[model samples]
Target: MRWLPVLPAETGEEFSREGQPGDAPAGEGLLSEGACDEHSVRADVEAAAGAGIDRRVYFEVFGCQMNKLDAELMLGVLNENGYQLTDHPSSAGVILYNTCAIREQAENRFFSKLGHLKKLKGERPDLVIGVLGCGAQNHQHDIFRRYPHVGIVCGPGEFLRLPQLIDEARSQGQVAALDLDTPVRFERKENLGPRPRHAFVSVMRGCDMACTYCVVPRTRGPEVSRPVNEIIEEATVLAASGVKEITLLGQTVNSYGKRLAPGRRIGLQHVLYGLNQIDGLERIHFITSHPRFMNPDLIEAIGSLEKVCEYLHLPVQSGSDTVLRRMLRSYTMDHYRKVIDQCREQVPGIALATDLIVGFCGETDEEFAETVKLVEEVRFNGAYIFKYSERPGTSAAADLQDDVPEEVKRERNQVLLGIQKRISLEANSESIGQETEVLVESLSKKDKTRWSGRNRKHQIVVFPSQGDEDLVGDLVTVKVTEVTPVVLVGERPGKGS
Candidate 1:
């Protein structure tokens, strides 16, 4: 229910088009300019710690679930180091904007927000302005040069050093904590403020796919999976804190445990099986998977596992083999179809979704038709469609020509959206009159009289509120009454009528 600005399309591909963290979920300061040595910075922080100064820190999270989890990590680290959380940026001494560079719009939005923080800094001399995560990594030097008032800029890899970096940034004029190659230390166990019923736990960080159009690998660094034990511990702690549902997050979630496997190998199936055994956990979900890693074992586990939810966010960036080859996606349309077929056969009633990039560097009309044909064959329950745009430093930008015109891109985007809308509407209508369970989350932003939650298929369901009993965490059964493209209008069996 906590509203955070997130780009759903960036959850996987270049944009958060598919497998966004939620169905449709939805800083400041000024400081003196000075530089200090590490020893002095450390001594000042230690002295402040000894004096027990609990400064309030506010976090502005952007991007995907991975970024959200990273923000949680930041908050946990700050909390551990004698810092408190504040909802208001005006009241906080530290204002951190956890960013994403997946889309140009998201990056532009962050900078626009960053510009506003300057006014806050002008008002308060001691406010610490920091940028973390993807945006921090993507525009490391540019950000510092553009905004010299920004005291702290740490990438995802350098997150563990945040507590120390905060001190260094305060004492030093501008501190850049950009360490991409080194693996982050996430072994510590801590909670992110108040626990929600549904939580996102990152199983891994970064990507190795090296897709031509993606900036994730450059920003988040190489893939690194958390130890199986560590993930289980985090899940157990979440379960213990009344979290009924836990969504596993990663750039390529299906490719988890690749680096951690010693020899014989353990995959996401093993991890899901472990989490299933944990007490108090009801449903398990994972997202943003690559097609190449969608193995039969993982598909079978999804069908067999009692706790795993039946929703898969398999990204098919392009259906045309040529575009795919150019993107270096490592899998063909036939391969993708086989994976979809296997998943359909194994996991009955699975709600399938996909990410689509309509305009790629060299996409021809026939190639674009191939993508439409693939979508028609797949009939995805939902999709995140995007018009291709070049990202700086990506292979597509450097090696490939952006030949697709803007008008053509927009036309293709609309065409795909039209097709998918019919498919999604049909899918939702099929659920009419059926009973489904939902973990009631919060009131609908449009109508507060109605409460909202997501079903097992990850569809949003809104029903009339029943008695005001703080039903955020309660699981209730609702009969489907009406259908919308993105939301299902339902009511408690015999109560709302």
Candidate 2:
């Protein structure tokens, strides 16, 4: 285990939700590729069956879907080491907070939670408290300095080494494994536990884009595409284990194979084609693409592939070309328009969504208007809107001034959000009385009488669950009855309807 320099202990207090920490990095992310076989996993479980019967670990995950998947992988490693997963933090001997540093808000929430965890550590000194993921990568040993009781600080790439780190921390008081240069090695024994009906499979890890305001590249290291055969093998395992849908994950998924060895440079289209050939997988999806790599062939694949869902999340950070240039996004408004046009033309009725950042550095009212105009023209089915917050070490923070005032940022954010809410409502309302396929996932928290799932367009549809059937994991026909901006309320289709 590598030793991290322990910083001067600051008195642990309640979470303050204070200003951004000076060391906060860009965004939250993960990148790794490895294949695990079944025999080794079974052997580990058998060996640890008796030892782990009483040990429990509680995980608090934050940020993106990638972070959630990382938590799952870490749980698998802990399980193999004779630890069981628990939901309540107080009941567990080990508590892990999978941290995120995407924005100031996320960071504040994490620190607040960590501050609260300090009391639990004081009460139970034997309990192992650790922080993992992007935030851990950003602060590293400094986390030890701030929260002296924190036993381990590990990054996303260092997750596979978690068991060893936990043991070493128990023996030596504090440990950190924040190395980004090391490749993640997933041995055959590292089983990612039970498979759900729908799962996220990371085809590639890391980002190569030098977007001014983003820290994904720094936290996740360089982009590394997993071998196509390895991905296929993992998907095959998922299908055999009853997974019906698979969403391929990456920071910029469209640039799938650019960083592979000389002869293995395959595009996203080839990988989609290969996944489409899998026997039991019913649907496929990929996300968080950059327009620079959204070539014509990729659009053609989206149009032609039957298994690939009719949904794409192409994040257009800003609508104004000036803003895009300053963000170092490498694409213009006209180029983005062309990509959107081609996607709409090729894949009709596709539900397009985007990630929009309002009030970016130096954004004027006129530039903000351009964003509203783009939103009106695109009429996106859904969007994730965010107010710009400078990330330390990012080019934007280093070179540009965060000139947009808080009031201006709030105004622009609300304006765009209002437009998107209206558009989303109108778009969803159009689906009423239409029949669609929904893959049942779970009981709706809002209404237990109904089950929730998503359609090919990636829209959530909730329908009454006729208790006679096990709808979970099954794709069933639903008739839309009512619509909301966020979800569609539906019912099981009658024989004729």
Candidate 3:
């Protein structure tokens, strides 16, 4: 398996809160996308260290990395405030639901889940439920008005006030709050659960990207990065507690610090460089870099930092500049090409992944062909090709017409996916018969005899343990013997041919 920089040890922690780790609100987070030395890192240490409130708390996360990291910190906040955690929603004193709103479909699912909770409240009238994260921020009173059972609503920034909100929720059955409006960089909460070998450290919150089709700016407020010192300290603590990998999260990570004036800022590249120095940190990674923010220094850091993985998930939502202009992406196709060229030059064997929308509002066949051409040229390792789904309150929803027919959109999506399948097959085939360093993550879901991990390029690798009981969490070299569209099959070095 690849390396995860084994951490010292810590207590347990939650997965993420609904408010995005990015600057976006909860409902607007779907657009993106641990265990550790379990027990050795005991869970909930952060709770024991802070405020001392110990009521039962639970979290249900939706959306992407930002939300997950929010959930992680929320646990510390709840524990410090004296809220204990319980897995069952029926038994909890106060139920917290972290929400996401990236696409129409994910939002639809959010409501469906909310419907399930309505019946629970009927059974136990005192069982208070609060909606937090993106959903609370995006549709604040709607959740409360639509479902009276949802007693409290708060955005990510408002999580600190949850204890008081719960008390207030008891009387009105609705408490609306959000932490998004203030200057960010609050104190890091203590560990709430056992430390995993990996962790998510949020560096920034919100977005200023007025992308025509996005709700981030409206729901999440504006871009605000955490001070560098706080980030470094939190990461150091994670390293000391046995976190082997740390993923720095933000809305558009590359744009970090641009919103803040000079002397008060350190960019994402600087953060990556800073975190590289932390003891026990074996690997570092960051996400959602905008094309406009892809700087040379960040490119060079990726190539130079051995601990940094060679995987870049750059989103080129559409290939046509006309469509991009309408979408307010702020970078052209040629500019993206230059960034990709720089990435390949800097990080050898870099896995290039991206996001693409197949059928956006008013997208033409010709424009889509341009996107196809772009895909052929880039030959991405993987592409999240999606059909445009309108989101209420977004700029595009107000200004643009939903012109593409559903079937035509579907056809275009299939064509793009076909192109991606070809590219993915070719990209994966290149690794065959070649040896790659892998980090074992988990046992295969389909077969326990096999182990599942990923390479530095972020490609999934599944291989047999080869009877070396000492296989999990260790870095080992393996030769790619087979390939699939999504996974790479390999055999350990020195194992039978």
Best candidate, TM-score: 1
RMSD (Å) per prediction:
7.8, 8.4, 6.5
Pick by lDDT: 2 or 3, better one: 2
lDDT of 2 by residue, 1-497 (tens): 00111110111111111122211210111000000000001111222223342366766666665665676677766766777665467677777878766666667767877888888889888888889998899778579988998999998789888888888888898998888878864322222523257767777777888888877777888888888888888888878878788878777888989857687658989889999998989999886688899999999999999999898877787889999999888999999999999999999998887777877889999999999999999988876666788876678889999999989888787888789888888998999999999877667756667777778887778787765666778898899989877777878867321
Candidate 1's C-alpha lDDT?
A: 0.73
lDDT by residue for model 3 (55-167), tens: 66555665665665666567666655666665455546666777766655556776877789988889878777888787688887588778888888888777767778888
Worst 10 residues of 2 by lDDT: 30-39
Q: How much does candidate 2 score in TM-score?
A: 0.87
Worst 10 residues of 3 by lDDT: 34-43
The residue pairs that clash in candidate 1, if any, are 8-16, 9-15, 9-16, 9-17, 10-15, 10-16, 17-384, 29-121, 30-121
Give each model's whole-structure lDDT: 0.73, 0.72, 0.68
**Candidate 1 lDDT over residue span 1-497, tens digit each:** 22333211111211123211211111000000000000000000111223222276766666655666777777667767877656567767887888867666556767887898888888876888899887798888798889877999899998877889888877876799888877776643644422267777788888888788888888877888888899899889878978898888778888888769678687899899999999999999887688899998899999999999998888787889998899888999999999999999999999887777877888999999999999899998877776787777678889999898989988888889888888888988999999999877777656778877778887778888867567777889999999866778889988864
Q: What TM-score fits each model?
A: 0.88, 0.87, 0.86
Question: Alpha-carbon error at 463 in model 1, in Å?
Answer: 1.2
Clashes within 3 Å, all models in order: 9, 0, 63
TM-score, candidate 3, is: 0.86
* lDDT at 110, model 3: 69
